[model samples]
Target: MKFFIKLCIVGLYSIPFAYLSVQTDYEADSKTNYIIMSLIIGVLSYFCGLIRADLPLIFGNIISFSVSYFCNSIAMLDKKRADFFTPINSVEQIVLITVMSIVIQVIFYKLARRFAKGYINIIESNNIEKEKRV
Candidate 1:
């Protein structure tokens, strides 16, 4: 259930990008690329959660954004647009996305932990009642 919730969160985060890709006359290939990138980010978040108490969603987003930026710059060069990477248009984009991802993941983690604890408590109570009957 926790994994399902996490997957939903990931899908929600990708929606804006998916919509933008469609609105901007983006090539089908580029749209597919973005989807693949998002999946990679989701997988990275999952692994990060395994090692840490909470998922480092913000860190994963930053890493994903940086890689995407680098790739975009390279693509621009291929088209003879620029020789180097351009500065990001909005620092706020990074801050907003990072904050949102972290907050959402933290909330989900807390809820999942609470649910798991409640499940264990119920099981323990049931065992205790059984023992009492015996």
Candidate 2:
């Protein structure tokens, strides 16, 4: 139950990140591509929290960005692939996305640990207490 709650929290946070990312390239990336990016980011963040590895902020962002780049790359259709890769501004675009990912993940890491430690009230472990009161 705790795991699910944490996952959901991260997932919820990702929606804004996706929106901001799309704003960076409103003409370039479609809505569906960013939706997939949000899902991937949430799942990666969840695993990073579970691993509790050393330097999680550094490691998690690196892994998350690498996966997202590939996913975003693949999400592009064949017709756009050639035009997308050769543009002079492509490097600039990637850099912006990288920075956005870092900012979002860093904020999540700061807040998620605090949220996960407390009782969220979204889940009730004992219905028995309410039943007895009734």
Q: Which candidate wins on lDDT?
A: 2
In the range 1-134, model 2's lDDT, one tens digit per residue, is 65655454444443434334544454665566655665565555544554443254454455545554554555454555436545543435556666866665556555555565443443454565677888
What overall lDDT, based on C-alpha atoms, would model 1 receive against the true structure?
0.47
State each model's CA lDDT, in order: 0.47, 0.52
* Total residue pair clashes for candidate 1: 0
The C-alpha TM-scores of every prediction are 0.44, 0.43
The digit string of per-residue lDDT tens for model 1 on 10-125 reads 44444333223322323332446445534544554544454433433553354545554444444444432232213532233334444554555555555556666777899999
TM-score of 2: 0.43
Model 1 regions lying over 4 Å from their true place: 1-91
